[model samples]
Target: MKLSAETLADLHPEISRPAYDRSKVTAGILHVGLGNFHRAHQAIYIDDLLARGGSEEWGILGAGVMPADAQMRDGLKAQDCLYTVLEQDASGDKGRVIGSMTDFAPVSPNHEGILRAMASPSIRIVSLTVTEGGYFVSAETGGFNPDHPAIQADIANPGKPGTIFGAIVEGLRARREAGMVPFTVMSCDNVPHNGEVTRAAVLGIARGQDASLADWIDDKVAFPNGMVDRITPATTEARINHLREAFGLEDARPVFCEPFRQWVLEDKFTDGRPALEEVGVQFVPDVTPYEHMKIRILNGGHAMIAYPGALLGLTYAHDAMAHPLVRGFLEKVETTEVIPIVPPVPDTSLTAYFELIEERFANPRVEDTLSRLCLDGSNRQPKFIVPSAADCLKAGRSIDGLALASALWCRYCFGEGEHHEEIPPNDPSWDRLKEASRVARDNPAAWLQMSDIYGDVGQSPLFREGFTKALNALWENGTEATLQAYLND
Candidate 1:
């Protein structure tokens, strides 16, 4: 029998075949964005926490800060805020229904409701999955963009704020006035020093409203740096069918992801927090090594393949990884250049990590889209690809592969190629990048001159030579030939 709308009783068998009271749970954390990754990672951790018969204090209250959030809110709400999470591995796929998220508040209608919930003594941690761009950080500088219209609107209207940071700052102010200690602002996004970036954004918005509140936030709120990794792609209808076939149940918002999941967080929580460490969360004094390792290696390698793979007409990341040329290009860049700049990761061999990365990329079932990886190249390049390129240049080393990656991205922005691919709209500055790249065919310095994007690397003779060389090669011989050249060089 199909499940009734209210109680997902039909899902009971799939949720362990044991009847349990969902209402027994209470909300303790308010997650700002209800994205696919969060459902696969953080919510899954909380599910494990509940399974261990502890931290019943840490149920998640999912909230959406924008109109895009409404769809997720409605989907989760329709499923009774319960969805199946399918974890895939080399062995096979396993399934579970994550019932940890208890409630939903769409920020548009319930903006005040969100603030009240946040200000309550019950809510201890405010976590976020708002993508890096949602932070309104300047893509070039990695700082909060005060001039952003959203930032300005949020600053002027603190009570009914529009942006995530504004909502957070307003909530904190309410909590402070109510004699409630602030909660940890946990950022689950994939960015270097994500916690620090989050703190800057909150403070940047708050300082414009009230100086004392900003100072209080610094003194009281705990912004913990975290490194979270998982390969969860956008869920499609095919994915939904796969989940139903595997689990013998239907869930509209089910999250299908690779079995691998890791969350390394700073063990600093002010108000109160979950015993998530019990459920495989590594609470560390510093997550820098892991952060650096993932950022530079996995994410950096992702940036490397994205443009080139997109250029090659490969759609999924696994397909791209399967190609000899794209695979070789990624390995060359990562092993020869990128890894050298990364400090050694703890208790993990960087070599083993790369091997594991290859294995992960080879997982066809995950279906991570190459185009998704290529999106937001403007922001992703500096964080994921540029640092290593700059370091290699400074050390008087060759960046033949790195230069090729950048040129592929530049070519991608041109909106034409073997795929007849109209460049998907990415980055607010795409028009400028396209114009500059068009002009840069003759003047390589034209694209490099963006101080916000390239920094001092633009002025370096080595980077200029490398960029010019690779870009010219791509223009002349194209991506495949350029890859062959780098492989042979």
Candidate 2:
């Protein structure tokens, strides 16, 4: 049967459903992006909290500013904002219906509904999981890009704002005018120092509209930095069908993820928040250590494998992990280069953390895609991989494996996979990256000159020489042989 509020009672007794009464739950959080990751991760936590017989006021009102979000709204509405989360592991699969999300606003051009939802006094927290690139950070300065076209448009027309930040600013303005307290603007994206980046974007947009309002927001509002980790792959038709076959349930927007999930949040909210610590969330004074550890080892490990995996035409992440060369390259690079620069995280050993990451990547049932990991290199490489490389360079550490990873990125951008299949447009700067890759085939320095990506690290003689050798090896010897050289060295 189709899963909905009405069908909750009829589902298989084995399938987990909400223990708390969904009817009594009220909206206290307005989450901006209703993507699979947020659904499988944050919503699940809230669901767990409510099931424990409390936090009834902390239900989620899902909102989206982007045009693509309209489809999500439709899907969620069809299911009565109740969807399935299929957690897969070596043991088996378990299914649960998440009831934390009460409703989703219709995606609109002006985003009037979303603004009103955010401005509501009852909504104390405005959380977001928009991807890393959605923050409008400058590649050159690594700060808010005030000159971005969307920001410019929002500045000119403040009342009818077009971007997410614009909507947020307008919402905050309405609350201020209504004499209501501002909501905490928490960013749940994968970027390092996500709360700070969120604060910069919101303040930058607010400053363009009214300096006084920006000051008020800066003084009153809270943006808590957080680190969220979950391997929730994009849902496929087969996955949806699997829900039907496995549990006799039909869910339009089911989420399939690995069994593991984590959220480390800085404990700073303006009004109040759900007692998330009651669940598995770690409330910390500082999320930096945890953030650095996960971003460097787990996220960086993904970067280490993604390009070469895609070039070699591996489909699933576990398939790449199973390959001897790919596994060896990841082990060598992370241990020798990336982990050495990572600062110590409390209650965690970097070596054990890497082992956990390897185990997660090798989860066969999760089926995380190599192409998904390989997407948006322009944004991800900076956040995930390049900072480690830059730190290694600054510390005068060997960057041989790191350089090879960068070279693989450049080669992957050549609009062809290892089997010469046509690589779709994966990056925002595809043309430039492709041209640079073509040029660097002859002179390796050509790719590094794209300072927006490589920055001064490319100019380092050690990095340059290592990158040159890696690029040449990739071209002359192929990915497997190149990986062997890095491994054997």
lDDT of 2 by residue, 426-464 (tens): 888889889888899999999888777777787889989
Off by over 4 Å in 1: 1-21, 245-248, 419-421
Residue 46 in candidate 2, Cα distance off native in Å: 0.5
Per residue, candidate 1 scores C-alpha lDDT tens digits across 1-489 of 222235455554544421335567788899888889999999888888877775677889999877777887787787678777777766777776778888898658437767878887888889998875667666466577888897898888879787778889999998889887788899999988899989998998999999999999999999999999998988899888876665567776878899899999998888768888888999899999999999889998888877888888888988899999999999988889888878987788999999999999889888889878877777788778777788788787777777777778877877677656576666667888888878887876788887777777777787778889988888889889989999998
Q: Could you tell me which residue pairs clash in candidate 2?
A: none
Model 2 TM-score, 2 decimals: 0.98
Summing lDDT over every window of 10 consecutive residues in candidate 2, give the lowest-scoring window. Answer: 450-459
Maximum-TM-score candidate: 2
List TM-score per model, in order: 0.94, 0.98
* C-alpha lDDT score of every prediction, in listed order: 0.82, 0.91
